[model samples]
Target: MNEFLIKSGIAKGEGNWYSRLTSSLYERIVWQKLNNPLGYIALALPSLLIAYIVSKMGFAIGVVILALIIGLPLTFAAMFYLKFGISLIIVLSFFLLGVKRFVGDVQLGLLMDFLIAVMIFGLIVRQVQERDWSFANNPISKIILVWVIYNLLQGGNPSAESFLAWVYTVRSFAGIMAMYFLLVYAIRSEKDIYFLIKVWIGLTLLGTIWGYVQEHIGFLPFEMAWIMATPERYALLFQAGTFRKFSFFSDPLVYGILLAFTSLLCFVLATGPFSKPKKIFLLAAGMFMMVGMLYSGTRAAFILPVAGLLFYGILTLKKQVIIAMFFAALVLGVVANVPSSNPNIVRLQSAFNPTEDASYKVRMRNQAFIRPFIYTHPLGGGLGSVGEWGKKFSPWSPLANFPPDSGFVRIAVEGGWLGLLIYSALLYTVFHVGIKNYLLLKNPKLKVVSLGMLLVLFSLTLANYPQEAIGQYPISLLFFVAIAILNLSVKFDRKPELLHA
Candidate 1:
């Protein structure tokens, strides 16, 4: 029987066929090793160390070291495995740290650290594989490259301090690219996109609850740790020893931005293809986010949720609702403008009137003084230059004591007009891709995602005019990811599933 089978060529020989199959299996096993858990641990070790240090040693020290560590191989591994995981981790950690100097200060530093790690990883990846630099043809990247070169030229000889600062600035721009790549690559499937949205939704709700509890009950559990660690600022804010809510975010602005973004997501989910119970839950979350936004006391914070609703209404063909929203917005604006006995109204008026307001005037005066330097320098002062210049060039400037009030102005001052142009172009591309996808896709699910992302991007762009929105890791990461997802969809001609209306 064996001879007959062999002669017929049905089987070489029973043992021969078995051996070939085994050899093929063995070769595959040798060539493509199964992912080991130890590898993940090794990769995450650097980030874990940073997290540990931040938890134990406070933010300033932790952030510097964290940045250094992230530039290493281990943390790079974790970031590679998860895709946007490192960015999300650092952002969430920053949010957890809140306005307490340890947390807020560390957040930026950690972001820098993560970016350094990503750059190192990118270099290695480029070395290992032949990458298509066609993506570099992106207008936004070109603009940023020009901006960096301009900074190098204008800044004169790049000393260690200047170089490091330049590195820091360039890293921020590169980090945005890394985020974009990660999103496009990792979120190929609708399931992955949905999972990310769920994570964002949960975090939003948690942030809102934290803000609510801190505001109403004067209870800040984890957040108070950092506040207590740095009691000086707490003392300044505390009137009658009552703590104003920073929530688990760096400041009220951060909290407000988070709420605004989350509320936009909630609005999308509530109106999208979710079940009745899920929709109800999302509606409740949206309401909670609105309450949290009001408590955040960020004047520009209202722009996001309001703009989101406006966009959604317009997209859904609800013209009357859009009109109603506009009227409501006008009423709110008038109320904010009115001189009132209420302290909140007084604060609002001060914020609105930049000329008479101490804070607003200081910001304007600093900008006016910095404008000439920015124009002449062309490249920019450097990445850390804006903050450093504020301290060195204009120590008395209000911005020296405070953070940059506007993201666009911050980039323009630090990276130059080139940087600003690049950033703007990047944002414009996001909107363009998002809108294009929305128009092209017949599927309602894709349309909703596209519209939601577009709304977030638009809201963020508007918010950037008033606050430093781009530098905030969570929002920036979210913005890039959304754009990447849309771009990928367009490239591959993949259609998202339709929602049952």
Candidate 2:
């Protein structure tokens, strides 16, 4: 068995950690079990129990068991490898909620929280071995720490209506922030950043393709079933005589914002120091993503890329940027004027003409009404005092029925005006550092990459004004990762040796 492990390259050398661990595991599990009757019975018991359960419960239970068996290796891989874990979390974020379409009601979203917790543990173990923590010593890390502390303090908010609501909401509030520090610590080289960007862009392209299919072909049967399961959902989605395209995300809002911001990122990266083939692909992907964003029928999404472009143009102040912005404005003007009864086009046009939108007016009214309550409550209503948490945990409260449509509004209501002030400071610092980093970077490629991330962040920031943008799964995860990259790009620029650090 030891010889086989060495031959198979599982054990690099005789006295290494891998060799001893694998050799010991093999001997104890296979060799010792074979020589002892009780050991053989112990191994057989698992198979016998599995067979009995299958026989009694049927194929579904057997299938579940098989899935768990398969998932065990994947889970362990994530636990041991930080990069693999981050990539897995991002991939799962894209489809975790969508899985409910086929699987029925289940706490699948919690899987993200679980993965984050495991990765945090893995990070701690790795830190113990390495004994170096300087990677996270940056302004980005400091602000994120401040944000996490504030969220955790929400549990003690005297005005909090329900402690249970805090429990449910704080997981995302303070918990997912762990990924930022993990990423800052784990990312040692430019290649790591490239790998992460590739994973993000590749999955985003797949989502764009899926959204296109749902727009032209139609949703899958299960997706349709999921949409029609609730009347309010069906009504919300089935807009303008067609259902909005959510792709693999939880809702059209999340899907559209993702496509919009990622498309902006792609377009910005196209101008980076890359081969012509890569540039062409980025341009093509950006177009497809724009199409997907339009199909989502989300007015908020319609403005994100436009906002991103404006931000990019301001930061660069180049002739190419001026030309790009002109063309963008021209294209949007044409779309707004081209007399089209199509709902998607109409929705896109309406984004530019917000004053005419009834929903926009309603959102404004809600924000106005909530302004007084937010001002009175310094700590806000607590993390989960609004949205579904409020509806479930404190249904009788006025805030329960109130709809905080925007991310900023939700934060203001839940965290209070003071919390909102701190959150806003965090946002301001992110952009302040991001812009400063982008300006200081002398490397062209690093500059473009930093600019791309900043633009994406800018789009998300704009999106939060109309939708709960960064509070969702993939967006929240990706947002922190982008910040980490942006903060590190300047370091890479300053010392090229850090590119391979």
Candidate 3:
């Protein structure tokens, strides 16, 4: 039998073409087994365990023990399951629950749910696939991996405090991944994209109405009780006798971000791809989104829509609008910087001047205080080591008071300057690819979409300097999808006409 096998080429160098082919096929099967289903499962297990443990423990000592038990498995899993949807349901469930629980005192529960969703999604993706795995292959799956890797490398420690911080990072990553997957995978063609955009527009309109009610009617649904419970947090909006909008999201910031993005999408559809009726509808949606943005009172959120319009104008035949928007931006900047006797106007003015601004000074002071430790721990204070994580892990550290405000700073503090550089490079690459594709693509609609996406990234980059918006779910997922879509669109440059709506 051994001689026959050797002679057959399946054994060594012996046999015919058939034997060689069989050997090749066998090798392929083995490789596939190592790379596919089995490998995927192995990588996802640790993240699953981490998700479960963190859900129960709130990133306490239990997470450390769990990480210790499953760390190697997680490492292996990260290598294999690079694009799986292991955490979709978990995150959606958490977000839905958060929406429901926001009315009550379940902020912690909301936080836990969000974290669990993020952890599961992030780890499974990291462990399973190769680095090149992306949305064209499976936008949702690849984004999940991105989220996991981002959260995992965020800090060094595997302790409870770090774990809790990980939860937030993970949730943000997972949520956005879910949305992108739903958008790209479920929506097969342009019509589907249109339908989904309409749905989003409708949702935004409804959310605006709901927000108005919350502000005016004194009717608090069970879903929004948590916001009501946090009187201190909600008091400013409520007391101002202005509309305190929540827009089917957890907070004004989140609501404003979603509204801004959706509005930009509407603007893209209006100006680039659709029929006249569609454009009209989109215009209406854009108007509503603008209203939502204003009511949400997120000054930072204002930049996205305005920036998107500027980009759209620059790219399209809207030269007059482009010039108008440029002057408008300049005027706004000037007005926002003008010191005035009016307190509200002065406050708005100060927002444009980060140097003398109270909030800017606070951020700078925090950065100053944390610089020494960051210098010493160049590899990062260790995952979840400072700020919120530090408060949980190393409460003694002087840097604990520095909230993880900036996503860039968060990465710098956790992974050190090296990690921040990598992140920055990745972001730059996204913008670069987006701009190149936008300029090259013949499809006017896609070009607008690409531009809008680029604006999202640019806005997030700016926002991250003052706040931790980049890693948050939905936003992060959107960022990656935008990048992926732009990257995929680049392939059509030679045949731009083929990509037109």
Clashes of each: 7, 1, 37
lDDT of each: 0.62, 0.87, 0.58
Better of 2 and 3 by lDDT: 2
Instruction: Using lDDT, give the best candidate's number.
Output: 2
Q: What TM-score does each of the candidates earn?
A: 0.69, 0.90, 0.64
lDDT of 2: 0.87
Model 3, 42-62: lDDT tens digits are 679967877887788787666
Residue-level lDDT of model 2, residues 378-476, one tens digit each, is: 889888998899999999888888888889999999989888898899999999999999899998888899999998888888888888898887899
Clashes of 2: 1
Off by over 4 Å in 2: 1-51, 498-501
Estimate the TM-score for candidate 1. Answer: 0.69
Q: Tell me the deviation in Å of residue 6 in model 3.
A: 58
Candidate 3 residues lying further than 4 Å off, grouped into runs, are 1-200, 218-225, 228-244, 309-318, 326-350, 353-356, 386-389, 491-501
Candidate 1 pairs with clashing backbones: 67-113, 70-117, 98-249, 98-250, 99-250, 150-379, 151-379
Higher-TM-score candidate among 1 and 3?
Answer: 1
Higher TM-score: candidate 1 or 2?
2
- Candidate 1 lDDT tens digits, 22-135: 544443443334245544565589678778878898987885785466545555565455545544553454454454354344335554456546545654575368665554
